[model samples]
Target chain A: MTDHRPDAGQPVTAVGEVRAGGSPDGGRLDYGGPWRRVSRKYVGVVVAESIVTGVVLAGISLFFALVIGAWFGWWMLGASVLVTVVLLVVAPRRARAIGFQLRDDDLLFRQGIMFFRIVAVPYGRMQLIDINRGPLARVLGLSDLKFVTAAASTGVSIPGLPAAEADKLRDRLVALAESRRSGL
Target chain B: MSEAGGGGAQRPVAPAAVRRAVEQLTDGKWHRLHWASPLLKGGIAFIAILAFVLANLRERLVELVIGQTGGPAGPGGGGRGGGGGGDAGRTFNGDPISAIYETGFTGVAILIVIGVLLLAVALFAVAWRMHSFRIGADAVEVRSGVVFRHNRQARLDRIQGIHITRPLFARLFGAARIELNVAGQDAKVELSYLGSRQVDELRRELLRRASGVQRAEAAAAVVAATTRSSAPLSAAGTSAGVVGAAPAATTSSPAEQSREAGILNRRVQELLGPELDLDAAPPESVVKISPLRLIGSLVVSEFTLVLLLVVAALFFSTFVLHRYFILFLLLPSVLGSLGYYVRRFSKAARYSIAATSDGVRVGFGLLSTSNDTLPPGRIHAIEVTQPILWRPMGWWMIRINRAGHASGRGGSSAPHTLLLPVGRLADVEKVLALLLPGLAGADTQGLVMEGLVARGRAASGFSRAPRRAQWLRPFSWGRTGLARTDDAVLLRTGFFWRRLTVLPLARLQSVRVSQGPVRRMLDIAELHFNTIAGPVRAELGVIDRRAAVAVFTEVSAAAVEALRADGSHRWAS
Candidate 1:
């Protein structure tokens, strides 16, 4: 966990040692808490979605190839299979890459494996905090949290949190947002 | 201070008197727009159609002109008289009025014309009556739409700015249109065809109410307004930056008072009316862009450079390479785009920026002029840039991000984001002082100048992108850097277009750090300071990952602190 921190052991880091807080949502939002990753079940949901997409794509290719020739069908079938395999292999790590931390003034979210992105959205600047659950994620008891600011480019989303944790996070964020609401 | 100078006789209306005058207009009852509302509303299309019909009827005018030469001698004489001999069938088969008689429909046509005129007049009268508005305490409500009614009320607190535009037709009628620029997309409430005289007072009254000025503050604001207005006007004719001469305005004697008023009136006239009807500005404007400079700058601008390259290519292929057909195809479009930009720039030919009591007033246009008053603290970000050719000329363009722009690429309408089209570096500094008063600190002012003009490796104090990042921006890596003041963060970027963006900390919504596989390998990251959407993209492309993390932390904390301290929303309070 210490290795995950950038500039580790450096005093420039305002992010202090992670510790647990004894509250409903406070534990996850604790200033001292370790950065929280989305639920592991999210990997299953992602794999399920990838399978649906892969099957649809291959189905279309198979239809075209059957109408035309087996040669075209073989090429498209091979490509679709390759894509599905890559997505299936990468789903778990991609799910693992997503994490968030609550600081003194803001909530920091980080994601991506190949292209890393981290955003710090001050509580006061938050215009909207939404919780959405996909059909597969719902069945897996996982949810996604999203934040909107005045800037459209600040499209920050934390995907695949446990359903219960998501509600806790929502309540905590809404409270913090209300107390510090400032400029739009 | 005004009282101490015995300047009360010349002092403009005081707060109580001014409020009393405003109260007459804001009586909280529905008031109809100007009498010419319907004509201004529907008359534009009507006039266009009339012009089209007259153009198609040019044959009749020619016939009348040549009719005297053995043609019809009298108004009613013509028709099968087979007049004008050979030319009879071609055009003046006689007068059009006489043709109506020959066709046996003169009485019917006359009746129809009278009937249509009556109906139009009746309709306009009703619309003028129905289209009414009410100015209440907390909100301004407008009601209209005749058969299908619409009632919209904009809250006083939400009024972002006030815009008054005088179209050529409206100006001919001595009327102006006012748009209440509310703080949302398509949220503008428009009141059109108000008497030009009424518009100034109405705009001031609305802005005053929107400012949330209380009775006490209103009095003090009047004095401050006088002081500020005098400073800019006096600064115009004297050595610049006489910003702190507020006290001097109070100590003037009766003799000096009259002289100042004369200069004030003369300066105002010069601002409003310049010798070249197209370009108007105070004589001492640091960069008074004349029509010649405007065209000259366009010739050297990047757009023209691209155009010249394409034309040269066409010439080469047509003459040397013998590809003649290609030239014919590309030449027209190249010429068309050149014409388009020329027209676009000229529509805003008469550009001027001045300090008004309500806010900074930016005016633009040629035949039809428009003015917008941007209230203080509404500007989210400021961007100053110089295209490569403009650098040596010391010409720069300034743009700012506000809550929302009511117009989309409004060509003849106001160019919404454009603060200064073209001006000298000194003009940019003066405009910045007016727009962002918090930059008054000498340290921040110095930082801004360094960001604006310092190019090449100058050893400026900004945190420069490292040498390793040269691969990312081969030519511009040396020029890109980030600096911060207590109130804002400045990110300077680009090579040919040398750009600087200032994002006030209070307006920041979020901070972001991004790194791709290549950037991660190089141990560098890009930092983004998310502000309200506008032309200025505030981002630091590649910096040390550790520095990115540190600055990200600092900005987040500082932005929150700035938000807590911000009181500019209700500036009057």
Candidate 2:
């Protein structure tokens, strides 16, 4: 088997290298450990959502075809089929792009494909760290971790982490937040 | 400080002192306001109604004059009422000229007018008597009611500010209303219809006591009393004794003794007395906004842009509708915007920001002047904005979020929050220096300018969005960046209206890094620095993913270090 070390061969950008201990080395910064992706079953969740959307679109199209004419129905069916195919192809890729990194003082969340976004929420600034489980997520044993800060604009919700991992992160964040909040 | 102490000591102890103090502090013995207060409160409404009645009578009175001049003596006609009989034969609008002889209508109208005047006078008298306020050692209580009594007390330490407002009519009478804004309280403790001079003295005294100096002295007195006497005095007794003794101690000076008598003598002629020049002693001027710039800012503002659109619509309507009726429809809105601009700009005209020993003082206004003194260490956050249009002129507006009592509503219209309405970039630096004196260092000015106008990747230690990310924000991608100093995090964004947000590390409540689907494809992120609800909201958009992570970690760590170094949270204190 090939040797596997998470930190051994990660790409380092000119901006900074991600170090574990959060110490500044020269002009470099510590961007915490390697990002941990959400559960693989999150792909199943995305596929289910896309399927439901496709079914809804098809049903609307079938109604239009039956009530109006067969030609309109055929047009809507083609459109719905095209949309479903796109979702089927794109859902897994989209799910893979979402990842989060827990640092010494803050949590860094990165997501999206074309319009990439990375959000960092400091532990000290967290007013609330909530865990939410939807019906599908509950069935799949996955949950979302939400971070609420004092600022209205800076809230973050990280979806599709395993239930166990979500709980552990919630507890860790709460403990860190408590210790750091005394200064504020 | 010595003058305050001297003035306090020489205050009279008998009629003026004991009576005024007791009336200001206790509910047992209340005092009525100046007798003219009734007329002052409701006189205008009474006069208006009376004028309406008189106007209605004008036509009938005129006809009576003409009838007496031309008609012959007739039945129901007495001395000064008789006129030529032939003239009385004429009719006005088919009504007989005898309609003017209707005494019943005239008598009833006169009686109704008199009755309305009496009711207005009585209502004012009742309102004047119902409202009374008492000043306690540590709190001011205002009690007012006719049938249902309402009482409110504001603690001296909790008092944030004292605003003296003189409406046009009040200014005519040299009367001003004192509104005491209390921290965390929605309602203000108002003392209305006080003589302008009394209002000034009362405001000064309240502010002085609120500053905690007098409270410390009172505590010392309590300690002395506790040690000297075996029997414990009641809470009210201790407070009353301290209140009476502290003023006496401060007012004992010989020079103040003469001034005390002069104040008492003037109190008798309060209404007719010269207006108390309400202006505060001007602080040393740092910057004065010129009228030309003030008007120019207003003309180029977004409000004026809307006005221009309306004018264009009006012009366009002339060709389409073939009439200028649209002008009638849009005239009010155009006039309204013009009036609003005039009022806002004219009030801000002669705006002068000054540096006081403790903080910055801002004074502005033409008709109703406002002088606001904001002590250092109380500001929550500061924002320096350069609108896209104002960018060419190199002008910036600096606004601050203060710690105590959020202004009643949103928007920059909130009084006292605006540090500079419009000023050059250099003026922004001066105001920021006064506001956050601790944050300035050798290269701060350069860093500040870079934060304001710098472009491209890594300009002045800023990590800008990569070129690949430019597709999403084509105009602003190069300009948007994040930079850090030892004490502050600067976030710059916007292409046309470039905004620079400076957040001191210690004041930061939280930091957030967020990414979306489009950003994920480009490997970019956004960094948001959360502060308490304040004017300065710091957010850097389209930062590279790696740099965003670095920013998140560094800013969080730096904030902790800054807080530790500062020891005390400025906002909390």
Best by TM-score: 1
For lDDT, the strongest prediction is 1
Give the per-residue lDDT digits (tens) of candidate 1, residues B18-109. 33434555778777776666787787787998887677456555565677565645534434332232233333355664476567686688
**Candidate 2: Cα lDDT at B184:** 39
Question: What value of lDDT does candidate 2 attain over all alpha carbons?
Answer: 0.60
Give the top-scoring candidate (DockQ): 1
> Local error of candidate 1 at B367, Å?
1.5
What digit string (tens of lDDT, one per residue) describes model 2 on residues B1-573? 011111122233333442244235333234444345555566578589768756644665677577678865444433223223232323444432245434335455557769997897787778767776666666888787788899898776555445565555666666555667643324567666566445545664555455443443445542342333212112222222232233333343322322332211222223133243112333335677789998888777777777788888888887777678878887887888777887778568778765432234576776655555553334546778877778668888987655344545643224466778899977776666556543323354567666775554446666577887788889888878877787787777777777767777766766766666666566666677776555666777778777877677787788767655542221111
Docking class of 2: incorrect
TM-score of 1: 0.79
- Candidate 2 DockQ vs. native: 0.21
DockQ of every predicted complex: 0.32, 0.21
